[model samples]
Target: MDTAYCTADGTPYYIANFAQLSESEIASKRRQLICVECRWPAYFKRAATSGQGACFGARPHAPTCSLGAPPSKKGPGSNEVQDILRNPMNHIRIDINYGAHDKVNGDPSDVDKANTRGGRFTGDGPRGPSPMNRRLRPLLKALIESEQFRNSNIIVELPRYTSLPANQLFVNFDAVDEGLANEFRGYWGLIFDTGMSADGSFWLNTGKYDDLSILITPEKYDDFKRKFNFQLDRELEGMHLLVLGKLRKAWSGKLIIDVDDVDRCALCDD
Candidate 1:
């Protein structure tokens, strides 16, 4: 776990030279790292104040990966997360009412009572489908890591829109067009580059066709950066972004999603 690949910059990141990056840069790199050998996902763990060196860890590396980092020990609720992810008939509700400062409410203990239709959790206790309010980050990670999840029939509940199948609710940036305008969805895509408009609005420019972008209004700029621990000066060209917002066509004939709150967005290094 001394080295990993940074998909954002397409380079091998060494742990020893970790000090060279600014705090913001380090935070950004932490989310985008992957195993150098097997290409499995990896994360950065900051050095403890007790003098332990900073290191990298992965959920589970490929079986053939030489690093030998064992798969993370799963708890009683761990398999349940994946179970609901793969089962099409399962329902997962997303509660976006929390603020950026609030903890991600992904705990299975907070299961939604409304999700009792198909009896996905009838017999099993702790191992059953713990249908609860999901956070965007984990759901976005699932979509990126599993093609089956992207096409799954899992029902996701969001504000105003109620519930819809995962495949219908999440749309890629390249697939987005004016046809989806006024429709609310979880718009996900890569960040080709970023820009700050003259009016102080921040734009996460998607390099996809038709000049698609995610706009962070001047009002939400500071919160957005603080929530994501983002630095506009950092090289964010290849980062993946997911925003829960309504698609709209700009006055300039460009497709865009204007994110109203920091809690409505998620960004990853992959």
Candidate 2:
């Protein structure tokens, strides 16, 4: 694929013009890339060492998508819509079993977020064995690939938080605003840019709408990187990130989501 639609600038992007962009420009636009035809998530593939030129690609497009390659002579076409129907997402839930370190009030930095206003909680320590918690990838993938799922009234319930319709619960970064402040929502978007603060906390930011970002504290850095295979040096500008957290405005006026546990977040490629 050579062309894609950028939701950041609301324009079509051609790979041939990719080189015209500076490093910073690419970093900003790459995050908002999507398929021009079906609007599925899209990504930029940099020119490889093997001699391939830079190009655009996306998750499997619907069979009817004009950008998708033709079906092979040996088999029928791929139908994302049909596949979603065969195995629909019943509901969204992420349950993380806490360890001794995660006990409430165990560490000085650990604060009980409940019964308070504008207070943040960092998980005490390492998470215990993951129980049979439903993964968010399938649901996130469905939301990205299926318009029906995105607009559906499916339920998304996070433990300790109020359940809401999928349409209302999952908000893209582009739609974030002050009205949504201090509420727990499934905030998701592309990785426009990333940076490490002097405090050693890392930020995966969407460079629009008050610079919405997901914060990974220093305590959780090791676990977060190990869980997500994250590398700051890598070209991660266009990857997808979904975080289940309370949307809060920082003292600096930046919209932020503090990820207390690694399990509360998920990342994927287009």
Candidate 3:
């Protein structure tokens, strides 16, 4: 998971920081981080040959994921190459080298991105609590002070760092001790599935994240909608198809929303 853009430990601590503002304002400012970190690798060669696109413009699931099977409307895996071909809901490669502008406009790294280019949004009140993460911090502080994690809800905490504990937000939530940590709130962010290419080469297709972006070309989006009986709301038809790619650690049949559409965007507000 290590990458030049991520922390030394390879976690995306920064992306979690975006929701503190209105989702739309994030793009005007925050995505600048992704554009610089992910899209523009210092070494030109690495940018072209080695990097996975910072912003995905397609689905997030690859065939190799545990729930490679379709969750939206399921039957059985199509044995035929054509059926698989007809519905590209299967594994698709994400082009690591993409125009910086395109990814930002798609789902955008943060919620507050839509109809914007650069700058930040501020001057607001009652924007809700700082975020769920802020609430988690004090809850963890109390657990450490009580010094009885055996009965405390603080789970997944790192071993004491010298005398300090790792922040509760970054503690590995997957490792939560269910028996003792049922009441402590935890954020169940979507789990994205990425994997190797059809040629058996590893690739970080962020599209496997189903929630990323559809990246459907203006031409293709229109063509698909006109040809099919399904009605893809005109606004969203252009966005990528979203569905949780995997089920192991993510929710089942979770709703998928177009990251850019004003309405679909609300599903993420949770």
CA RMSD, predictions in order: 7.9, 9.4, 22.6
Error of 1 at 5 (Å): 18
lDDT of each: 0.68, 0.65, 0.24
Off by over 4 Å in 3: 1-18, 22-25, 28-58, 67-238, 241-270
**TM-score of every model?**
0.61, 0.66, 0.17
- Predicted structure 2: lDDT: 0.65
Scored by lDDT, the top model is 1
Superposed Cα deviation of residue 35, candidate 1 (Å): 17
Off by over 4 Å in 1: 1-89, 97-99, 102-130
The residue-by-residue lDDT of candidate 1 on 152-270, one tens digit each, is 78888774565788899999776888899999999986664577889998888763232788888898888788887754433444566889889998799988899976777888753
lDDT of 1: 0.68
Instruction: Rank the models by lDDT, top first.
Output: 1, 2, 3
Q: Residues 34-101, candidate 3: write the lDDT tens digits.
A: 22233321100001122332232212223233322243443222122122222222221111112222
> How many times do residue backbones clash in model 3?
14
Top-TM-score structure, candidate number = 2
Pairs with steric clashes in candidate 1:
32-269
After superposing candidate 2 on the true structure, give the runs of residues whose Cα lies further than 4 Å from its correct spot: 4-13, 28-53, 57-65, 68-92, 95-133, 207-210
